[model samples]
Target: MKKACKIYDEKTIGKFVDNELSSEKSKTISEHIETCPICDSITAKYNHLSNIFVQSTSKQLDKIDTDLLGQNVLEQIKREENNFFKKVFDYFSPKLYLKIASIVAIMIISLTYFQERLIRPLDIIGPSAIVNSVDGNVSSVMIFETKKSKHTIIWFSEA
Candidate 1:
């Protein structure tokens, strides 16, 4: 005959059967079961009780009305669609659209004003000192030298 393990309380024994006991406690239980026949029998009984509970709960869930749940969801969707346009118009009324359009218009106008006032003026003034260089044979050099710069100009020819 197999040895019986020590009897633990329902809570502690439940945790032990679920493999949730701390390692040291699990080791103690293992050692006790090795020697005590009664405890081993109690552990086996608790394990059987736990397995039965799990199996019964699983079987109960198999009887739910999935088709009725699907029909209720379809009815809700149909009711929502009947008032779809009304819901949309309420969400995006003239006042709300006007507010959004005004914000976008203000952003565009501000950007245009800043570009004209600040960026255009800078473009007209242009950047600092310009340098021009020409490097080629005599004819190429002569053709390129016609370009002028107010700052330094350097030319190199390989005739």
Candidate 2:
């Protein structure tokens, strides 16, 4: 009499039929499936399901036109890029646009005036004065303003 199989579930038979099990285990399951009518029927069903799944998926992929889909995406991106600025401007009236332009002009004029009059150019602004005296050996004194902080610095050297 043939030895009875301990494993009879559909998962074990499916794994055997799909060649998912180790070589030795797959051989053993294959032998058992041949002898056991119930396991043989279950393996047949799993094979049918696997074949149907692969065929249906491939058919769906063949139905789509990849080149046409790619062109539609590219055209949409170009249309959005050309229309973005126009859309923002369309939200405002012509009178509002003039008002915004004038405000920006006034800000630029004020900044220019302050930069010319209040902020002196670095190259033109130098040491205000220098004092030097030799009491016994040697001594020198120089006074200048810091460029960034506008604080006065006095340098003295004696040798």
Candidate 3:
């Protein structure tokens, strides 16, 4: 006759019952149970207890009242809708848009006025004066040279 194997602790037996042990550990436990009658009895007891707990808990949950939960959710949605328009009006008021538009318009007008009054006049005045002076000087020199020279020969010299 084979000798009986030693019984494992409740924790190790629970892990084995729940299929949480590694393959090597499970094989060792199986080998021990094959030779030991006490470990086989403990494993059977754990299996019976787990089945009873699962069945009883599932039956208890099926008896709970779910009608009140649905009613409470509908009440909350109704209360939110009653205040929806007021919240939207507060967020998108006409006065806010008017204020923002006025600020943008003032900025655009000020920028346009500054560009026209300051930058444009300076640009026109500075370049026009320079070109006019240069043209006047060149015209005056040409008139002087023509009036002073009767048969003048201009020679090019390299400096």
Candidate 4:
């Protein structure tokens, strides 16, 4: 076992081994660690621990069943996709369909009622009034017809 460092702590030495310190600080620590045996041994220990961690994690990853993991992930994705469509279909329930159908039926009935009762024909089938005689002292006569009630206007203009 190496003695504890006086200037830099074990954490600082770990940072140096990981190259996480600033360039200037790293240079200073590197110089100090080269001279101090205690820091050097601690840095070696940190490096050994880091290497062991990398090797063990790599071995664990190599031992994993990647094909099984991929199959499970794909199955979950398929289930999620199916659930999305199921939710959309569930939103249009029987009651919602009945409401939609009722609204359409009401609209059709309202339009039929409006066409029959509210809208009037602009043209009349026959003459609205009979012109029996035009015997007058007028030079010109003008006749006008109203649209909705089919009323007639006889205007006599004298020269």
* Highest-lDDT candidate: 4
Q: Is candidate 2 or candidate 4 better by TM-score?
A: 4
**lDDT for each residue of candidate 3 in 1-159, tens digit (9 for 90 to 100):** 744345677688778878899989998898987876777877888888888999999999889878798899999878866787966765656897778978999988887879867666555532232222223223232111123222233333332
**Full ranking by TM-score:** 4, 2, 3, 1
Runs in model 1 deviating more than 4 A are 1-11, 65-68, 74-159
1 or 2, greater by lDDT = 2
Candidate maximizing TM-score: 4
Q: What is the lDDT of residue 105 in candidate 1?
A: 94
For all the candidates, what are their Cα RMSDs to the real structure? 18.1, 17.0, 18.0, 16.1
- By lDDT, rank the candidates, best first: 4, 2, 3, 1
Q: Residues 17-123, candidate 4: write the lDDT tens digits.
A: 88999999999999998899999899888889889999999999999878788889999878876897776766775797879978999988887788655444433
Q: Each model's TM-score, in the order given?
A: 0.36, 0.41, 0.39, 0.47
- Error (Å) of candidate 2 at residue 29 is 1.0
